[model samples]
Target: MSLAKQLSTLMIAAVLLGLGARVATHSDLPFWGHWEPIKLVAPPISIADDAMAKPDSAFAKSTSAYEVNLAATMVLHMKRNKSNIHFVDAREDTLYKAGHIPGAMNVSFDHIDKDGDKFLALPKDDLIVIYCDGGDCHLSHDLAEFALAQGYGRLAVFTGGWAEWSKETDLIETGSGAK
Candidate 1:
């Protein structure tokens, strides 16, 4: 064959081989058939809101500015009363030991759940203030929710928590579970 004709034939063969390889490689796929129509089934919709109207605990909602400020004020009042109010630190021991609100008792979320019934057996009406590491921490919220579920109506969560309280030089610090 002439040089130009040979080159053209070679290119054509290469193109055909490439097309054949693609077709063979893709033939096993379900959607590769010429006339196959694909049908996608949508996932089942969940009606969770209808099944459960509200969260188990009302305190899960974001704390209002007034609530947070009031909680802080209450902590101060509790400090003065000493024997009346119970302040629980929900953060880990390391964080609590570093620095926490004065007289705050360290009762982690893990410990409370183990003996949930006994842990919550205290007077539900007693004033309980729960706090965690800081504004970003949710341990206090979890503790408050646990308390609320156990029929504690006077439970309060100090949203600002240790971070905000630690900023004050004279607020008082028990170095963890002192009180």
Candidate 2:
């Protein structure tokens, strides 16, 4: 939401709230409306259609979205160089303590949101690779979104994350700070 829209909403809500504070409303009025999932019917898709729109990995679970970043590329980057790229482990503290990508920093989504400067303290132009528990895990995505909004460029999501990464290699560790 934009600042102006949010301010307008707050003002209108404040007025309604003030009225509520003065008057005794009935209990019959529901505060929230019932919500149901909306069914969407899309036209049938074909390989040619998707290939033209966007090309994903061969093994990728048929998504119409952008391609997933190659975790091997990140692992290779880590193995080869240390300055251009940085890794963030967006998992719980305990899970992070168990094991994480080598030189990965335990900066959970909450941590980044609370003190973005903690991560922003680094060079904004450097590559930031974020990961979580791999499949269906969105913590890294959320953090990446936040970082991008805050003007950090050269961002990549290790979408395969730790699950896919750990299976491929044993370059895991326990701790904070990047190499």
Candidate 3:
């Protein structure tokens, strides 16, 4: 082809590419562009030093139990031995009142201070299974940290939480005031 025609084609391609890049970086371009700003948010900081200061540091430091994915089977096991284990729902009272794991007790983190003294009201030795709304919720982490601070050695966070529990058709469920 002619040199003029080739140059014009190249310029057009470059302009189209630039426009596409600009659109991709803009947040107003519908659902696909909404996540652009999230990529610019700050990264996570390390918590090793903060975790080391707790009395229950050994338990809190290790994420093995804290991070485990507890499915419906584990919930069923805990339900069978309800007397030995305590199901602590860490969601807010409103969510708790809406619906929660059957036989679970509400312990809203908003009520507990940073010192975690309020959680001491419960028996320390009980096998505590902490849960929140679901995998995305942070209430379980808040309650587990509080419980650990209060000197509870046996604590397991059911990361799947209410969402996973609700999926089980065989599991029993009651209204908000089951306890």
Candidate 4:
């Protein structure tokens, strides 16, 4: 056979082998789950007409967990010092220590056994903003679902999470749970 034919045959065999391996593997490594675009519910237009306060709205009434954009998270963070809004970092303690939203509390979804009390202590009636490592990270989502099941009425997930927050602003807190 010519060199060109040999090369073609090798390429086809490699492709088939790869396909077979992919089919046999149980883990979804190469492709993460379905690619549903993150749809962030718009933040309240202004403090005066705060949609957050009105739980009767369509989005609010439909789901217990609301997906918020970066702007909403930032606004809540700024007022965290004075307001009832609580920012819960769903990432692990190590990642939480590296950098997290200033004033955010680390209650990792992975370490719920250790941090469940801290999470439970927060006022369920108040808005709890949970976030993790952002894109493709399900820690925040899992935590939010757990919170909702535990009777936390008002919950918001900053879909962008730490990745987006760190990139967009310099407002980061580092240390072992000190902010």
lDDT of 4 by residue, 24-74 (tens): 985455465667533334343333446544423413422457777787677
Instruction: Give per-model TM-scores.
Output: 0.53, 0.57, 0.54, 0.67
What count of clashes does model 2 give?
Answer: 0
| lDDT of the structure predicted as candidate 3 | 0.59
Q: lDDT tens string, model 1, 1-179?
A: 89999999999999999779879888554534566322111121122323112212222322211134333434344443543456778877777788777777777786675535544655664556677866678777777767655566655566667777777545656564553
**lDDT per residue as tens, model 3, 1-179:** 99999999999999998788878887354534434321111121123334323314323333223443444225334543643566777877788887876667777787766324435666776556678877678878777775665566656676677887777545545556544
The model with the greater TM-score, 1 or 3, is 3
Cα lDDT, all candidates: 0.57, 0.60, 0.59, 0.77
Estimate the TM-score for candidate 4.
0.67
Error of 2 at 61 (Å): 27
Best by lDDT: 4
Report clash pairs, candidate 2: none
What lDDT score goes with residue 12 in model 4? Answer: 100
Ranked candidates (lDDT, high to low)? 4, 2, 3, 1
TM-score of 2: 0.57
lDDT of 2 by residue, 5-118 (tens): 999999999999966865665434444698542211123223344332222222122212122345443433444243456677787777888888877777778666664656
Error of 4 at 76 (Å): 1.0
